[model samples]
Target chain A: MTVGILFDMTKCIGCGACADACKEQNKLPGPVEEVTTAYTWTTVEAREGQYVRHLCMHCLVPTCASVCPVAALHKTPEGPVVYDADKCMGCRYCMMACPFDVPKYQWDRAIPIIGKCIMCTSRVKQGEATACATACPAEATVFGSRADMLKEAKERIRKEPDKYIDHVYGLKEAGGTGVLMISGVPFEKMGLKAKLTDEPPAMRTWQVLSNIPDFVAVWGVFLYGVHWITARRDTVAHHEAARKGPDTIDTTHTGRPS
Target chain B: MNSTATLPAGRFRLGFWTTVFALLTIPFLAITFLRFSKGLGAVTNLSDKFPWGLWIGFDLLCGVGLAAGAFTLTAVVHLFNLKRFEPIVRPTILTGFLGYIFVILALMFDLGQPWRIWHTIIYWNPHSVMFEVGWCVMLYTTVLSLEFAPVVLERFGFHAPVRMIHRLITPLVIAGVILSTLHQSSLGTLYLIVPSKLHPLWYSQLLPLFFYISAIGAGIGMVILESYMSKRAFGRHLEMDLLEPLARAMVVALGIYGLMRIQVIVRNGSYADVLNLTYEGKMFLLEFVLGVLLPVGLLAFRKLRTSPTWLVVGAFSAVLGFVVNRLNVSVTGMERASGIRYVPSVMEVIVSVTLIGIGMAAFALAVRYLKIFPEEKPAEEPEPEGS
Candidate 1:
């Protein structure tokens, strides 16, 4: 039921039509180019004479969404990870957390906010494809259910293993991104980020954070016990010295041995 | 050498350092004005490639790390009931309190909206590490104020409230230690999301542990260094008996941190990172050698531990190393993956310096007005004639 985009880099023609259509649809106010920016949410970068498109991977377990303190960014059931500006505190943690480095901030605004591809959730709800996919001339960008996208991608790779890289980018990266890609060249060579763990980054942080309650409980009990014993020893030694009074032996030392 | 002679003179000195603070702060304030009026791009050299810069690395990361002394010292004196270390509890709390104030100011300046910081309080995402950090920092700042309220009360001759606060200190110390441990370690958790971005040398599952241990050492080191400066500034006698034991504790903390760091590098097979001697590797060497190894080596010597001068040197080196360690994690370790070399603009450094000035100025003012360093009560001493 998860909607997604399947971008075939081999079919991309390096044209800037998708970029222009996105700007027109989103009403982004800035200079028009396929450059990476808060206004320009997508980039059709070139590598060795082939065109490769880059945008938000939109993970099933989104680290940007998980790390956001206000839950300003969240994954919708329809499959587009979206941002709510009304809830955003502008911490820029989402910028730091994105594995693909996709979230861009409007640094020049009076009040800044994160800007990234939303997978055109409004259009998809109305059964329309994303602007970039609709405007794509070469059939490079296809929109469908994630299951259909994965099935079609694997079939294409199987039919012509020599024609494609035989691996689908974003299939399991950061725990399987919603946007899938099949490229002729290796993903790393195409300036696509590589080596991300299949496990989501949020899971790593939680491994440490989940243990915190246990740590606090154990440490708290141990310290309290020590404080109690020290106070008791101090009380008893004070009375012992008082009974012996001023002219007693030189037991100058007292209280828990420093 | 009484307080009357030395205190005000040291504070109001119209000297080179004061002129420097003024010189830097004027431009610093001007840049700040530009930042708010225009935008972040107006004053900062930051780009999408480098979302964080000097503010996050130096002001936020290093500033918070340096302020660890307040909780560590408080726990030692109150929770552990080591009465010998009691003299340092107040000043360390003041330093920590002022340090957090500066961090908040810096964070506001760095935030794009700056006003919506309160959104974190109302909107709860308990899953976020930043959420934990946010709550802990706010709560701990309050704890610090309560811990230090007695000093302010004592200064104002409010004996009733002072007595009430004294009775409540046990719970206050417990809360402070817990909250500080939470945030101090969670600061490290902020970077755990960027495993692919952060270099392997700095990235580990044990980052939170490393952060907590190093911070404890940093806390002890700060107490040693600040206490030494306060001695000269206020003409107070050096409490060597207390400070020596404090230094010994720092040695153990630093030793543990250093061992763990070495183990992480060795187990990850990052030895080639050091052997290759690239820019990142060299920076790692500097942080590991000077920041961890050198300080631990110096303090481990029994002779060096006892000497005030040597202990100061060792602690200062450790503190310097700690600053580098944080910068290495937040900035240097991030350089390779970022594909852009980030050198902060002049205005960035100036704003940072201005914040430091404000922190120091506020600390000095507090020291002047409050009974932060109280003279010992004469009742405890046996009569001189009897002795």
Candidate 2:
């Protein structure tokens, strides 16, 4: 079963309990910052009088996993995209590719790896909710199977149309994220991108990359054909000069024809 | 007669340019030390908002694009069997080889976990554009090395190996061209994932095609500029006849690039953006005019194509334009979406300049010790009075 998180902005009270639990569970040091950084994985932003928690969307087909040269970042079966520090070369293509701008780098460290929320895959795999979800006192953040979460989000919006925006935030963004959100206010006002294509961004890169085999096959044959034709013509020209006379052959070697 | 008699003498002396290069290395070394010990934060303006900056844009993109002459010239001389253009082959290959080496060096500094660079080799990610580019670059550098091995072998009188390499030369050149075509275009494909993030004027589904075509133009322009500079430095003869055809080729490549660029812009329905004269629009116009229109106009005329001064001027303009285009795509195009302004730090600039200085020094040394240039037919010996 693919576990996921559903965050409801209307229910959140900006208590910062989830943020504290995240730091405690991850053993992250220092006080919680206003913004997400290498040390802070999640934050609650106060925007437009609504409390919005900012963290990794954990895309179904994560762009971070796709752009990595070394396959350091990958999606776990539990619905979280995880990172392997040992395999990471720190090219930062993932940071550049993530539409949500979730990934942060440890720029101050000589040897660094990317930092992002992994949706608490360890707890989810053991049939437990995420640290943030468990610590959420108001029940704003809930963890369940992706199907159940998406169903609840739709049900909530349908039952109280006036209380919601009539849409689920992550249902279609970046080809459907594992983390779902329903907000009374518009997503754009909460710092979420409203214009992201429903299709996965990785598919665009795949469109070009998939053509490599055909290109190699056709281009290889074409180059070889040109070489054969040129070599044959040069040979024929050489033989013709030889048949003409010794004088012509001498001049051909001494001077190139313009 | 001594073989050295035909060589250009006294040109490889330790002089003013060498001293300047040496002086520039001091700051680069200092910054490099700071970068490793104190970290990238101490030496660069890079942040999560601007993950990539001048190193990726100028060093990797511009360096690889300018080195395109190696594949282009190899195909022309070896595959096409254009024997008349053989004189410049060795030097062009040398420049291309050095270009790639320096690009890798620059990458080592840019990567945060550079020690794990070998993970790309062991790990496979066929879906990644970076994976494809990395493999192609590695294989192409090998192909280039083999293509150039014969020259080194000949100098040492290793006839067996030279003959073996000569037999393998045709296939080597073909492989080099294919590899180059893949990576040069793949570099542009890296930006394809950011359709929304990149500015509309620079973003297109056909980014790969644009990058490949512009690289061809820049490659030819680099060859022309290299020829002129070598003529000045080594006191060698300028092969105007060969360069004239190449100048025409540059015009055609840039012309096609310019037309396709306008077509893509129009088809994307962004023509209004072009007329609006916004910041992005202004940068796009500068890239188009400097890289395409100006160079194509200058080199289109026969008189200008034949004149060394005008030819070099046009070539320099084309090269400069190519640099601006890459920078626009990498930095300026993403700035609005990123909500951050990225300017290279002083240390970053020094590192780039130092890498270029190292390349030039390597090329000069290669020319001095190796048979880079064709022998100047020992200036027609004065006839004996009796004869």
Candidate 3:
């Protein structure tokens, strides 16, 4: 029942019509302020003779959800990385964790919150597709359950190997993003990062985290021992100095046995 | 701590409202207003590509790292009973307190919804590194306050509470030291999320170790700088006799940090990157040479280490080097794949400037009013020969 987008990049026309239709349906302010205020849930990035749609992939294992300290950004069971402004503390760590940089900040507001495509969950729940998918003149932006989309993508690639690159992004990257893509060219040439591991982003930190308790205990004992040894030595030095007359020990004497 | 000097007839030559503080506050106030009114964007030039700007890099990261001196010295003096270093404990703590307070301020401004800061504590995401950092920082700040409370009690002549606190100081100090170690290393762990984005030379599972070592080195350097500044500004004597031995310790720390830095680079198989010598390579070399190698070289020489002027110079170099290192990690090292570059706007600079200036002003006022430095007991009149 988890919904997602399956963008077939080979079918996209660099026309920016999807962007326009997205703004119109969402009642966005339009591209005039896309750099700041325009809410183009989907926009076309023309890179190296190919067009790519930049939007939330709605990962199956969302790094943004895991890293968010306040649970402001979350992944719904129905399959969307949803934003809750009330919960957002505005730390923006989620922005850093997202490989796609899909989340946008409403930086112009005095108390801004994160803004991102939520898979248009409201419309989709009513049995309609996302505005970008519905408005795509070329039917390039396909919508369905991720499982069905993945199956369809494999069929298309097998049916026409020459027409598609031998890759499906978001299948396993950052732990299997919901939105999948197929293109005619290499991903790197299409302005997408190549070679990211399929493992969850937070997986990188697990090693350090797993050993933290051990490190803390070992370091604690070592430091405590140093404190004890130094204290004992200082006590002995103090006693020996006390036995002698005043001024028996000097600064140079303390420098020894280091 | 107590002051032997009688109250001065007048204030310092350059008082709190000096031209520097005044000039600095203009930017600070302007930036503060804009930041609150227009959100962080109006003040900073940060974007989704570069979420953390200079404040997080400089103030919270580098500032807290340098301030590690307080607990390190506290552990050495109070816990280890090093009488020679006793003169430094209070001043070290004061510096640490001021530095940490400023870090919190910087963090507040950097956050988009400053109000949601409490959500970290209330919501409780125990699995996250940031959660650990947030909890540890808050707890440590509390511990620092408790550890520092005896000073205030002493100042106010609250003997009963002071005695109770003195008895508990050892356990409190141990707790503070433990918390500081966890959070300082956790700060470095924040970058583990961006393994690919962080320059390979700086990225490692050993990041926490590298951060801990460099923080110790930076903390020592900060103490030396503070010592030098106090001598120059307040006519206090330079603690060359104590600082000389400390310089040797600094050398040891720097040596280890340098070795670890190189080791991590090799272990990560980034040796070729340094040898190839691209822009990142040159900067990497610059951090290694100026921040690390030079200070280690200078401090390793016994004669140079003991010299007051040379020790101060080496300490300054080490402090700047650490600052550069932190900036490299938090800002310069990030891979902005979207080709986005951030140069903090004027307002952003102003806000950051204000925080530092206000911090310095606060430090100066505390030193003036509170017993920060140990009292210099005057020479007693020579007793009668037969008495």
DockQ of each: 0.65, 0.66, 0.53
lDDT of 3 by residue, B231-254 (tens): 655656666777887878788888
What is the Cα-based lDDT of residue B8 in candidate 2? 51
Choose 1 or 2, whichever is better by DockQ.
2
lDDT tens readout by residue for model 3, A62-129: 77777777777778888878887787888787777777777778777897878777888778878788
Q: Which window of ten consecutive residues has the lowest lDDT sum in model 1 chain B?
A: B378-387
Superposed model 2: Cα runs more than 4 Å off? A248-258, B1-17, B378-387
Candidate 1, which segments miss by more than 4 Å at Cα? A247-258, B4-11, B376-387
Note the Cα lDDT for every prediction shown.
0.84, 0.88, 0.77
Clashes of 2: 0
* Candidate 3: stretches off by over 4 Å: A14-38, A123-128, A213-218, A221-258, B1-9, B15-17, B269-273, B335-338, B377-387
Residue B256 C-alpha lDDT in model 3: 92
In candidate 2, what fraction of native interface contacts survive? 0.77
What is candidate 1's TM-score against the reference?
0.95
Model 2 lDDT tens row, B251-290: 9999999999999899887767669988888888889888
Give the range where candidate 3 chain A is weakest over 10 consecutive residues by summed lDDT. Answer: A249-258
| TM-score of model 1 (first chain only) | 0.92
List, residue by residue over B1-387, the lDDT tens digit for candidate 1: 334411463446676766788788778878978998888888887878888888988888777778899989888777777676777888899999988888899988888787988888998887789888878878988998888888888777889988988998887888888888888889899999999999989999888888888989987898888888777655565667788888889989999899889999999987788999988789999888777788789888889888878888889988988988998998898888999898898888888888998888787778777777767443344222222
- The recovered share of true contacts, given per candidate in order, is 0.61, 0.77, 0.58
